[model samples]
Target: MPGGTDSKSGRIGAITTGTREAGRLPVLFLHGVGSDKSVWMPQLAHFGGDRMAIAADYPGYGDSDFVEGATRADYARAMLGLLDRLEVDRVVVCGLSLGGIIALEMALFAPERIAGLVIANSFARHPEGEAIYDRSVAGARDMGMAALAKARAPMLLGKDPPEGLAEEVIEVMSAIPPEAYVLGAEAVWRADLTQHLHRIACPALVLCGSEDAVTPPQLSDELAAALPSARREDIAGAGHLSNAERAEAFNLSVDAFLSDLDEKP
Candidate 1:
């Protein structure tokens, strides 16, 4: 819980329900800015381990409140705290969009706790066409999310967002506090894990929507190229939220990647 308790050791915010039976290390999920754990509701049935599958609401977003003023570092620390409370020693850290930035930071600071890594619809930098983060922050703060939401929905969705899904997409994003969105945007802007990409030593999977404009395929390619053991996978007919927009294909990519790692020498 990012915005839970000011003290990492203390509980905070609205706790999301359900937990896996004890088995292996957990997959501790971190969501992007302007998003909550519910965004990954689609993955619950698919990715959680026998022991764990956890998604944390960023300090200010979702059920987590921003009692600590909300910083990217705070989110990372809260994750470590959650793992401590769960009595889990390690995790497969997965993140998307701004969440990926947090995963990169987790890898950088606490790689010992990470057994694997998944970076989806994310990048080490906002390359040429990936201007969504910057634009959303600026517009949402100055003019409000209405314009940002309208302009971004198409960029984030596939050519055809399956029936009855477009409105839900807009709602998930529009709920962000303009100010918290601004803060997270600033963190993403300031975060540059490019130099440390080679240091990600775990089994890493870098995925993107084939048509993603927010993070772009090139972004994941660069990450794959940089991480010594990383593999790149692209889900066709999807955009920023590949896991949600192209659930089947996206899960297949991740499953295959993880399965391959299990087979390695």
Candidate 2:
């Protein structure tokens, strides 16, 4: 919504920017649960040069098509469809939280389509994901999305998060359909990509907020440790929503990593 045009009802929704260049890989963004394409505005602005940059909304989360009971695989397939529609041969996929897990699935399912990866504030899987999701689904079932958004938004930021960020996050999250919320929680809760990390052959960057309470630094440390070609960076004073809380730092770190990859022979 912020980086590109939104679909006029009934059309599939995606935020796309930059001019497509032959032989140049696009930068594709996948956002976390309760978030949509708009969250990647900072990244799109930073990366949308001559190369393609896109931030897409998952089904039921935005203007995208809704598929009840969607799995992570479904999300990955949707991404593939987006790429195909855009004539993109390959992409540098970047994802945050639930989006990050989805990125891993994309690597597992279609490794050839990905040139590089960025996993931020995410884990292979949550150890107590079952209980966490159960409570979450139940809460949504009872209180509704607005209430859930208001309740959950605070836990995702640092002691003093970026101004206006919480409100923005809540607004996006509150718009999610109940079914999609339930389905998303289940998919993330069930994900276990530990064994598959070795299969991700592309260069990867792992990021975490030093103050992140949702997915702590230890989780990112483990992911960085497991990835074959990877580096870890921590953003001080940021929390679960690191990109939003510290957009300048996050963008700089990612830009440096992508620039380094561009220099490769």
Candidate 3:
């Protein structure tokens, strides 16, 4: 919940964010590892102006200066800080990949304030593959961005990725300090929210790209089923970063979900 000049507790750093003021609910966008709020550009364009939607970079990513002593908890704090700054009492949150995990953490930390949620391409518990985290740290340490991107960039995109986005992803990730990116990956692999799903009281949406080999649709289904108030959707022909790869269809699903929310009266 960070903001401009008049913060009470402190600052959440120079966060990069996108906003739309006309929609019913304020929407907060959270990006995944090694990426920034810009990842949601297409969705922002689709939903902006008429929708109160926002996308923000985590402290260390994008144009924001990195916060020292950073951890996932710090990420949540920073988002809450923004909410405080914006004078928003409640919001619908949407997040993909690592961003989804942060959104979940926000719900857990402040259930009373979250109106709804859309969690995509994420998991309650990371499946097997200790080696993925280990290798991420190693590759970042030794060979730098190219090596890490070579290892990671393929699985993140669909079978046939968009024309220029691969390079775009690589460029963003390449800007990250190798050690820092490794820290983020380790945080993702170490994440565990298995016991916390039942506590999420806000209305929620769970979705995954049909082609997401990372967390997969099964994980989304599991989360949806476990939640007291959650609906799950699957997007065809998209992968881990489905929101970016197939933004239009993804936005349609999101727009429909939000539309349903608007009709609740």
Candidate 4:
């Protein structure tokens, strides 16, 4: 694991794996809200063997410093800055939940910087987003991060879910600062990339858990239909956090997509 931190770049931190290879675009991962770079541990282990894989923490989460009133675009800028620090000109960006939204923002911000995209358990535009965002913000503010985590963690998984994984997820969520969570919630609610999806010229893989209650399969289905070069896949026995709950299936799907890209002219 090529794990390191960069505090010099204003507290933006990441967990990077794999050695850079010429002719291979690095894979950059962005985690959902309440999660940090560690959320993509499975992805790093699976993809790091053949290509560079990097997972970054959103501002104010994990080791990153708080960015007051940060929006999804702010997060995208942070990623671009991080890439600049690493001297990476192009990357295959993959993001889940809020991370996925940010990934789309990145595509919108600079389509030239992306080689491909993997958006998991996310939506181009959330219809009931205002209510959801308001509820999440108010919940965290009233109940504290830990209490909110305990209540929401169960819903994020499938019927069977995974043993002990809920606790693990809750632990991560519990650590998020209240202010960061509020801003992130607001960002998610305000996101409206529906009309802009066609502008993304890069190939995209839209993935979701078969039983995702939060973002559901329809969201991914919508994304698949909209993005110019997008495909959809659903992970069985998983929920919103498909990569963590059903890592093997998630990795295989993404790896196959990457392989296909490698074979292209």
Candidate 5:
């Protein structure tokens, strides 16, 4: 098991584990809008054994302070600021959903600082983004986080989720402040990174859960097709939250990607 050290710097908070290995870039895990750094426990434990692994909470999500009217670029800057504070030069970014958009923004802002990218269950430009933003904000405002989380948890998971998984997702989502949730939803659903995809000149692994109705596999396909150097892999029988729903498969794909990175000259 990986023991994490939780720390805060400026407006960013993160859970870090393991030690930096020479010639190997650190791995930074960014959570989706509905989750915090805690959602990455599976990944942190799996990857923290021999290399630096850090999972960050977006501003307003966990220990980090809220940023009112934060744009997608602003979120990207916040992550970069966290890296600067930690004195980490470059990293392999692994992100899901909202986290994936921020990763793209970071690459666009500072390509030299991004060693590679692992984008899962995300989109360069969502087709139903506006409607999603409207529905989500309305749900958060009306039903409240707890109720909304309870209602959506089942949809976010596969037909047969692991025991306690739905409860975990509901718990995590329920804790998010309504104001913060709205901000994150806006930042995620209102942005478009389609034209900018070709600019991210790093190795990328695009992952999609076969049962992901949220972002859908078609979105991942488009992402891989647009990115300069990227490949697509589908996690069978998994849903939107594949990282948690099918952790073993998700970690295996990530492990293989990391191994390839290590083998590079």
Candidate 6:
């Protein structure tokens, strides 16, 4: 798929397919700190067959232009701005890790604009937030993104990942600019959205990989319990990047959730 830039909205870059159909909300896929829009190829392909499916590159990642000292709010606003440019009134957001946090922020920022949410391998409030941010930034600053990717890629996958999966992860993470990685890490790890979860009343599907040591299933449990209308689903034997590790299962869960949404009058 080709990438297009919305220069008016912080240069948000996105790859989209399919057409907007009546009564069907568009699905927007957001990538994690260590990934770009390409990680959602499987999802875009599957969902695009029936309705509009979009995967966006956050500012400072992939084809999007960089933003100096960007915060989570800034990222959320950029996405909303993109929606405005696209003339989309409402959407269903599917996000993982860093992307999940941004998705929550977007819902809180504009509850009326969001139809539903699919949050995977993420947390409302990380237990060791400061420590994780400090360590990640230090590693990125010291070893650079390439070396950091080589070291962290394995930790992001399950005990037994598919062939070349780790190498694919390393390749993707290595391509991220060190500065962008550091900036994204700070935004993701330092965020605390616990108090605001109640404000997002949209239906939500909270997913976590059974083998995810990064955010862990416990975090998803807490997130589901906190959200007003949310449920939890676990991707068996998968890790932090469950969508990539188990695309078929992830898509099935999301499809079922969207199907339920469509049934609502």
Pick by lDDT: which candidate is best? Answer: 6
Scored by lDDT, model 4 comes in at 0.87
Model 5 spans > 4 angstroms off: 1-10, 263-265
* Tens digit of per-residue lDDT, candidate 1, span 100-154: 9888888888988888889998888775423645676678977786667666677
- lDDT for every model? 0.72, 0.84, 0.77, 0.87, 0.88, 0.90
- lDDT of each residue in 1-265, candidate 5, tens digit only: 2222223323777888888887667899998989888888998898988888889888788877777777677778888888887789999999999999999999999999998999999999999999999999999999999999999898898887889999999999999999989989998898798988989999999999999989999999999999999989999999999898899999999999988886355
RMSD of 5: 2.4
By TM-score, the better pick of 1 and 3 is 3
Query: Which sections of candidate 3 miss by over 4 Å?
Result: 1-23, 263-265
Per-residue lDDT tens digits of candidate 2, residues 155-253? 999988878999999999999888988878877777899989998889999999999988898999999999999899998899998988998999888
Task: Give the C-alpha lDDT of model 5.
Answer: 0.88
- Alpha-carbon lDDT of model 3: 0.77
Q: lDDT per residue, candidate 4, 210-258, as tens digits?
A: 9999998998899889999998889998999999999999999998888
TM-score of each: 0.86, 0.93, 0.90, 0.95, 0.95, 0.97
The 10-residue segment of model 1 with minimum total lDDT is 9-18
Residues 143-234 of candidate 6 have per-residue lDDT tens digits of 98889899899889999887888998999999998888888998899999999999989999999999999998999999999999999999
lDDT at residue 187 of model 3 (Cα atoms): 59
**Considering summed lDDT, which 10 consecutive residues are worst modelled in model 6?**
1-10
On TM-score, the candidate that comes out on top is 6
Q: Which scores higher on lDDT, 2 or 6?
A: 6
* Candidate 3 per-residue lDDT over residues 1-265, each given as its tens digit: 2333223323443332345444467788888886877788887777765665677766656655566556777777678777776777788889887888889999999998888899999887777536667777778888888767766788898897789988888888888866557656765777888899899988888989999988878888887888889988898899998998888889999998888775344
Model 6: residue 21 alpha-carbon error in angstroms: 2.0
Worst 10 residues of 3 by lDDT: 1-10
Pull out the clashing pairs in model 3: 1-78, 1-79, 1-80, 1-81, 1-82, 1-83, 2-81, 2-82
Q: How close to the true structure is residue 23 of candidate 6, measured as C-alpha lDDT?
A: 71
Better of 1 and 5 by lDDT: 5
